[model samples]
Target: MPQFSRHSRRGRILIAIGLGALLVGTSACTRIRTHQGYQVDKLLVDSVQPGIDNRASVEGTLGRPSFVSQFGEKDWYYVSRDMRALAFSSPKPVDQTILRVRFDPAGNVVAVDRMGLEKVANISPMGATTPTLGRHRSLFDEIFGNIGAVGAAGMGGGSGGGAGGGPNGS
Candidate 1:
């Protein structure tokens, strides 16, 4: 009976340790959900009507917009994003909404447009360094290349102070 009890206790301890490890592992891998920018309320968004809703009414309904157009036609943008990320990873957009309200010169709503994740652009950098129009220079060239070029040629007429004449004017 004593031997059996001892074996059972050891088995229980092992099972408890295994379960703890599993719980910790799963918690580490669990995704973190985040919301950014404007929070959308379906009822409130639906209430905004073109022509009937002016700038003041739209602002009261949706609060402040995320951004307003700087040039060309006047437009208000309300952007929202739902993101998810695992441990130490960059957050990726799971869903996105961009609501645009176009206005006429009188500041009355002309059109209301809603866009989803289909309009989202995923841009990746082409390379480590941006391409430029010039000769490729080495680290040493960039650092020390301009050492003697400062006073050379058209650069202030060498060191004569004026033209090719010296201090005494040749």
Candidate 2:
């Protein structure tokens, strides 16, 4: 009986160690979740010199911009985002960057600007219901409002039936 207990105790110890290791591995993986976009390098961004790099050179050096301005063709934007999420929660922004490069009419880089996460704005609606100018109506009101608005087909005037309103003489 003493030998059997020793063997069973050793088995239990091994099982506990395995279970602990598995849990640690899984939790580590959950914390390591990271999402990246653009992945711009600081050296590459600094290499782009305004008034010196044209569109072709800029594209060759830093690849292509993430997006071009909709209103102005000469403006380009390089956007980067890094997000981290643990388990099932929504990913939170760890880092974000928006590099705006403006070009002159001649296609030469005229200005370079950078914006960080500090510039981000979150907008929330003020109330549970949006206020409007028109009167509020329920489903019953909308369905029954037009019930008495229509008349019988012949009760109203027919085409060209008014006094002295025909093509020929009355």
Candidate 3:
């Protein structure tokens, strides 16, 4: 019978641990890509004309204003917020703008200013919490479009509109 050395066993154990670590590390590696966002249209004094830029044009350009000046209607605001999942990451308003476009009685693109996030107040994590919005329609009821109906095994599958956008926006 052949006797194996203790050092050999230890070496085998070390090799197994190394291979396991390599496999685990390789499996964990993944790639996530971020696509470029659309152009952020904001008020630029030199570019935007006050009377030329109306509510429709403004909305068409920037989608929607984040906020409007409480003091003045002429002054519009655009604010954007983003929260990083990393621990202890400071909550930040990634984008903000004070659309300062002063009009001379007529609604023409007057002098405008594109402010940075500094214009808006930084929101702390402790601030207001977002509330959960319940589903508009139950899943099963949507597909079937039946009143107060539940599907097999409580699976909400139907043509009706429900929690999820089924065939319709329902």
Report each candidate's C-alpha RMSD, comma-separated, in the order given.
Answer: 4.2, 6.2, 15.3
Name the top TM-score candidate.
1
**Between the candidate structures 2 and 3, which one is better when assessed by lDDT?**
2
Q: Best lDDT goes to which candidate?
A: 1
Off-target runs (Cα >4 Å) in candidate 1 are 152-170
Give residue 21's lDDT in candidate 3 (0 to 100).
97
Q: Residues 1-170, candidate 2: write the lDDT tens digits.
A: 99999999999999999999999989876854565557788998999998799999988987888999998778988888887787677777788899988999899999989998997676678979888898899999999986865664555545455467786536
Residue ranges of candidate 2 with Cα displaced over 4 Å: 1-29, 123-133, 150-170
Per-residue lDDT tens digits of candidate 3, residues 80-119?
Answer: 3433323334344444435554544454445566666576
The candidate, 2 or 3, that scores higher on TM-score is 2
* Candidate 2 clashing pairs, residues 3+ apart or interchain: none
Residue pairs in candidate 1 whose N, alpha carbon or C atoms collide under 3 angstroms: none
lDDT of 2 at 85: 81
- Ranking the candidates on lDDT from highest down gives 1, 2, 3
